[model samples]
Target: MTSHQLTAGICSRLNEPEHSDELLSSTPIVQILSVKRVGSTNGPNPIDRYRIIVSDGEHFLQSMLATQLNHFVDDGKINKNTICRLDKFTCNMVQEKRLLIVLAVTVLEQSTTKIGSPVGLQNPPGDAVASPATAQQTPAANALSTTSTAPAVSSSTTTTPAAVRGQGARSGRGPNIFPIEGLSPYQNNWTIRARVTNKSEIKTWSNQRGEGKLFNVTFMDESGEIRGTAFNMVADALYDKLEEGKVYFISKAKVNLAKKQFNNVANEYELGLEKNTEVEECRDSSNFPVVRYNFIDLAKLQDMAKDALCDVIAIVKEIGDATEFTSKFGKTSLKRELTVVDRSGFSVRLTLWAKNAEKFTHTDQPVVALKGVKVGDFGGRNLTMTSSSSLEVNPDIPESHALRGWFDAGGNSENFQSHTNAFSGGGAVAFNRAEMMSLEEVKVKELGGSDKTDYFSTKATVMHLKPENIAYPACPTQGCSKKVFDQHDGWRCEKCDRSFEKPEYRYASTTVTAGCASADPVSSRYMISMAVSDYSGQAWFQGFNDLGEVLFKRPANELVAIRDRDEAKFTKLVEDVTGQQFNFSCRAKQDTYNETTRTRYGVQKILPLDYAEEARHLMELLAAPWAQ
Candidate 1:
């Protein structure tokens, strides 16, 4: 490459912000001197940062290769003596050193010879050094420096303007302060002053690889937010050092691609704390934002897709007792449900799990604010707090205060529509707290014809029952409900890969009963198919174990024993359930088999007739038109 091809003194000139437009239009070419990788390769998503020394033929400056341009180095197209034009880049000052972040480049020429003798740029002699207070505050300045002591020059020495106006600055802490939104795997030797909006408890996990503990914290600044995670020993050391709602000057953390499945932060990159990571609590946190939320109204949850994460603020209208349940993996966990209402005159069920469920004791209808809560569409629309979620009670934010005042005035006594039930007009009632629909209306509306399943409630009387194939033997394991087959010597559950002396009885579904032809039964559980009738029409519905327990008033095992002992008594017991009316919440979906298609209605919940509540609901409906 010719000496004239390289722009001499361009390395120093690029640091000045005023000449950005001129330089960008000119597209100055430079020669690559060396490239080195920084940071460890061990992490969920390994960091691949490249530090390159580029020369303008007169002065060589340390620059960073943007992750988007890694292919240039990996492909060996940009090596020593390779000439490239700086198409787009940003100049950031770190520890009184100019660091150029190359965003876009165009390879110009490749050669095996040096263009010119270039020397590293140095600060002017006799410049005042940074004071001890400033040096102590900027930890990254020392941590990332190659020398034992970095010579920090005074602000007036060169005055490197930030490439992005108002995006980068030198804080009082002395290091280049970067916005959380701007931090990526490409940049290094930078610090961020952000508030720790939320922190999680240390959680341990055991897998085939090994067992280790980890915790996460969400950090936010005015620009944006990012999630930080520390693992094992690092987690233990920093969990207490970082407190929620406190601002800190964090540095030396590895930045990696954000795992969207585990992270809900808006930033594209996340932080991983290594052993050398530094976290210094900032005493002057008044200027930092506490927490930011993009809250969605409770009424809008009905339209959100299942398992979508959202933020919400509401008042705790009712709280349910904590309940314990064993997961399919046999791990026991606790969960509590809360009925929360907001100013939109809508209520939703929010479920808290594990520690959050155990620690909740608020009972004064305090306003609650939640971030990253997952939406559920089981019985109806609901919300669930996962490990990544942040929950606050009676938060000090303006929205929380406004909600508290509204509830104290007249909102507390106001009738709120619930997400659990479908609404109509000003005041309309359903049969079982859900949208009431007749069998004829359900068919006319083609409820189950669509791609999505439809749910509704109706009042109907049992007309007939399917007596055969009512129950099956299930796996005896606490959480394993798969059907078990009799193996003569022992019962076997193919799914669990284990055999037992006997199997536990569980109500069987029609789907499961079809598979029983290949296996012998051991014990029996409730799985009932019944024909139900109303004034509009009759429909066939399937009720599983729980719904059967409510209708039969006896366990499946007991019913099976009675059938074997006295056929007449079993027949009478089955007949007694006929002609009894109940409110049924049903889910209707289209099922296809052997080229045949039909709508299958499955009972979700069975509620006994509440005559008093039903009468009140009717009265409200009758008065709605008059009031209107």
Candidate 2:
């Protein structure tokens, strides 16, 4: 850090001789380094803190400097010297070695820094003391220039104040700057120097209503990276002015809290440049912090959900679709998924979004730096990236090239990720597809067919099969699925209190069990058989009155006998439709007394006649085929 880096301010106080005498005698000397007026988060306070990296050439000056600095003020708007006590000093040790420097009141802690006024420095107590409070408001150096007209005096002629000079004013303090580099807690203004790493190509957007530009840039520092955006007018200039790898000073940027649900970037916050922000291209880059992360551990990623922001790096394994999507803000975006595996025997899925996604897909193979990717969970959980995120592909980084060759040359580190089901809070139970059937009690192979070729086992139902090709008259009442009329010679309904010869359509189910010994998913075929026939065919179905008399009476044991009558035909019919043999299954409702399915269809059938258009639409979807 150079002294020129420190700014000079307007200090028109030394003009007063009395004020000058008090300043030079009471306060210790100082040399300012850097000054910044920062806004405070608490209350409405602002601070004008100076990074006064100080050193004392004389042993006596050390205690005096401490006493003065402890009383320094940081009220952003207060331009007066508020150096009250030198005891409240703070320092910290930095890993890098740096020269210990000292800071004095350079007058830069005020509005701006420019060496324009030598006369202003000559004046002591620019603003005369209205009362005793002004006594402490003046810087001691102002005394030298305060009495320009008085008899010129040097330190040899001056007498020290009543307080001891070098007897250690602060308690337990050590050999100050020798043991440290900077202050601890390192509190400073949001000062950053970043490079415009890949500025977005300038593009204009205009519509019938409005037009604007959405320009973006990636930012990198020693700590890691983040992204920033300029919308509309602001974007125009930045898009043209900002160049890649060029450092720039940034301030007054609006911080963006990342949308964790959408982005896969690791930063807690993204940022957008506000209209009032100050952005200047800096000539120096050495002072900028280089962004980096040690990559704590990869195994922890297994527990993270998709769309989580994280910093991860590993060699590429496979890439997926480079499909495009529209963002919620109406901007166009693209995405692609990749499988990234590391030495931890874990392969995490990475979803790259937008331009990065496109770039990754186009690259043949690149060892990448996925610094701020967000983890997400779509159909499957994985990592994603947002605009605030940054990516480096095949950069000249050691971790990148090394990981690439390490995984490529016979590394068992390429092991696929383990699923949550594989290892639970309990433990892992190793089993393959072959052993799954036995464990699940399922039959895999099917029975052979006629011509003795081969056969398949399905589980379908014997729905609507009559006792011996049966017949029955249905009830005439509306909205009733129950079979009301049951007669040997004539017709009568005991429930509806009506004599009936005509019948209404009702839900009549098939009676058959369907399942494989293992999984019982699709074997039965259920009401789908009836639905397919009634849905596409011209045949009207029998009402529930007929179903109750024929199929529902016998238990499943008795119904199996019919399978033997024409085993080939039965086997072929089941095999043709489901491609599996029928098994044990019955289609029963939650309530038997309700005559449920029949009642449902009964009411549904009448709606079309009564409500016409609505009924027609309802009838279109609410049928057996739809039921299937």
Candidate 3:
């Protein structure tokens, strides 16, 4: 042994509560037995801390270097079998264990050279042995080793603030609540006292493997949060007992790695309730963290990519009737659409599925709070509920209350920007397919009279394709078709803030299609601007970009390139489509151009005419009351 060697026996004395403070003042000389960085379980932005095991020849104890003294370990001044003295320190109770907090340290023997092996008890402190690379293990860190059930305690026992304090002071009688971060599959004997932040609806599943029902609850403590799931019998047993925002002492449950896809909790492991699991409600939950939500504002939702998951709180501004639909697999499900608005002056659509859809009732514009909702893009910005998601109407959270108050105070009447991308035509198209309408009836009914755009489909014959001014040069950026200006060096798009060496091409054209056989000069030209006759009437229709490509049977860029080469070739191409019949889905609305308000028709979709379907539609129109 070296002359300055201080045996591990002197270090073990610091573990005693009585001698800890005394030794901190009179530095204890010990050898650094082990040093490693502690793995932080906290979400992002974890602090760097080092845990060290030190020995004084006769005994050794685990300790942590204070943040200020972390540099000693980080700088390589502390290593295995290195002699060190606690120049200044503080010993305090952390998680029921006397933890030595090194405030300052002095190296008696540099770590540049290694010494003989540890002098104290050859084993590390606590129940588990530590390797040089292993982090220091205090009782709280190793609490997972406690395999026995926690002491039996009645749920009805008093858990008031005062009673809780009394229990902690009672020494052995106090409850041993394991930190959530300390939980892992390797340890089965531990109890966690946590507050239920959210509980999902019970969902039943059937598959080739088997059939079962399950429900999940998200729980959190001061240290961390995790999700617990109960399946079949276990789910049935605990569904009614676990209430949101209530604390419970849960034990005898299986812990496993959590699924990364659907969960948002920071912990990597999840708990599974079994037949032997015990859950006793805790009356006093003041110490546990209340439901914490990382809410995404409505306006910020626009910036999120498709299929993102987030939590949202907003006021239900509009509710659409629940609709039932059959899937390709023959499974029937109900879905309801809700338009929710927040203080951000934007409104978004939220979809509820199955039971949540069937049970939802829109009354008094209640505020809705959703957790772990999946972001979806059908036409525009919308949210969809996932199996693990939970929804609460008129939740008592602060944001809910604030929205309710604002809505009652004239917020409801305020004009909010709608994020729904559905076309402006009211009932223009229901779901993904357009409503069928005849050109004569569309003219008589004034389908686009309302402020909103209307969508309708008609089968018509192309009278003539206007050959003049057919195509335009468009921005070259992907997904951007805005026309660009011809700069001296290159084409420039102010909207995209980009300059391209060459511009892409697209087409917009006016095609005259007739949907009326009788062809009343006025009514014939009414539905369409230019003339071509169908079974009902002649009308002018508009086609642009994607729609134009369908009519021309080629890409707009190719057509534009061919047109730029020879105008006669483009004119011939347009004339070739004359008298061709096709089905067209169109958007009709009134707009002012050149200070004159006129009804404008634009083609939204174009496809080859289905003769059988067109015949059926004509028969339906003939038997209508308007025809009579």
Order candidates by TM-score, high to low. Answer: 3, 1, 2
Query: What TM-score against the true fold does each predicted structure earn?
Result: 0.46, 0.37, 0.47
The parts of candidate 3 lying over 4 Å away from their true place are 1-126, 131-174, 261-264, 286-288, 326-333, 420-628
Model 2 spans with C-alpha error above 4 angstroms: 1-192, 197-211, 216-228, 251-278, 286-288, 326-332, 361-364, 412-414, 418-628
Indicate the residue-level lDDT of 470 in model 3. 61
Residues 169-287 of candidate 3: C-alpha lDDT, one tens digit per residue: 34332333455544566655566677787788787778899999999888765445678899999999999999987887788899877765655554557888999988877655655
Encode model 2's per-residue lDDT on 209-300: one tens digit a residue.
88777767766543224457788778865666777767665655665654444323333345576676556665545443344533524566
Candidate 1: residue 119 lDDT (0-100): 72
Q: Which residue pairs show collisions in model 1?
A: 507-526
Which window of 10 residues has the lowest lDDT sum in candidate 1?
A: 147-156
TM-score head-to-head 2 vs 3, winner: 3
Using TM-score as the measure, the top candidate is 3
Q: Which has the better lDDT: candidate 1, or candidate 2?
A: 1
